[model samples]
Target: LIATILLYMGVALFCGCGHEALSGTVSILLNYFDVTKGPGGGLDVFTIIDILKYIIYGLAAGFFVFGVLLLVEGFFTTGAIRDLYGEFKITACGRCLTAFLMFLAYLFFLVWLGVTAFTSLPVFMYYNVWSMCQNSSSMEGANLCLDLRLFGAVTVSEDRKVCTGTEKFSRMCVSDELDLTFHLFVCALAGAGAAVIAMVRRITLSSDCS
Candidate 1:
């Protein structure tokens, strides 16, 4: 309970309530690595790489959550899982196997969500720019850059082909999809955790039954 509270606090701090408005908290980090600007209108490889990096980071974050569960299990190796399932009690190695497997499944979902979100985040927040060519001279030394108009609000480009319409929709969709996955993973993990707790209770009940 305490840990969950702290986690909520941390998210709230980063997301803020209504006092201060903020946008794409993580996209700001990608800006630092972006260099696709100037008169060339060339591609920004660095920014792309960084965005990819963050996607991986997000995925890793999800995996880390599952890793924590592994650490917890390592500390408390109990035989309750075996007692709950007769097969586990009959076989020396079978005891607690099902619980462990279920726990593993929970962790797997977590890691999968982490990875999926990691790659999808930047694409979800991507934007494009557009500009018209009036004269040959303008094309000689003209370059384009994606400027954050309202701090992750709208990425303005020289061409004015803002990534606001289709891009924004696509990104929002991806973010929502990843978010749903995260929530589902959380639910599964919670269920697994609850099962473990129940098994522990069952063990106690069995002892009392005898």
Candidate 2:
């Protein structure tokens, strides 16, 4: 009873009062790693919420797979599954789900990391080039830079200012794909979160059974 009462209080604290505004008490007390606007309000940085989403997704997928298995087992003869293998249990199922989620999270993290890294190619090779003279750098033997923007949509002048016409030393390329990369990164984080949740569920199930 005490445990139950404490749990309820914890939930109430976590969720805040029904009448209270979400942005009010919750923001003040529970705003742990929430990301707001980025530099100059341009973008939002990664936050704990993004990771939580991934974990939730993984947990959801685990539940879905468990449901499917239940349906399949139901169709099978009562002891058929046990006869072939061993007695199936929800705790084991949860662990399996956690493992699957972890695998998916690893995959997503790899892909997100790869894409984000590749997208940095332009920045490394050359960020700006002369748009008018068609060369950003006067350095001899420098590799001609790859233009990220449309062929003629923009250019950089010798003064290093952006302009419309073919200005020397204009930006050779600009990255717009990073936003997508960021989104993917966020998804990968969700996968990570799912893995965590699945593991937690596995532990909880084990404890409950014990």
Model 1 misplaced stretches (Cα beyond 4 Å): 1-92, 127-145, 148-210
Candidate 2: residue 10 Cα off by (Å): 30
Which digits, one per residue and each the tens of the lDDT, describe model 2 over residues 128-183?
A: 32132333344455544334233321233211133333222232123222222333
Worst 10 residues of 2 by lDDT: 17-26
TM-scores of the candidates in the order shown = 0.25, 0.25
lDDT of 1 by residue, 1-210 (tens): 232233333322222211121123233223332324445643443344445446435634643474455434432344554356646433445336535544555554454345335423433333111112112235444443334553333345523222323444234334443344333333333433433343334334333322
- In lDDT terms, which candidate is top? 1
Q: Looking at model 1, report the run of 10 residues with the lowest lDDT sum.
A: 14-23
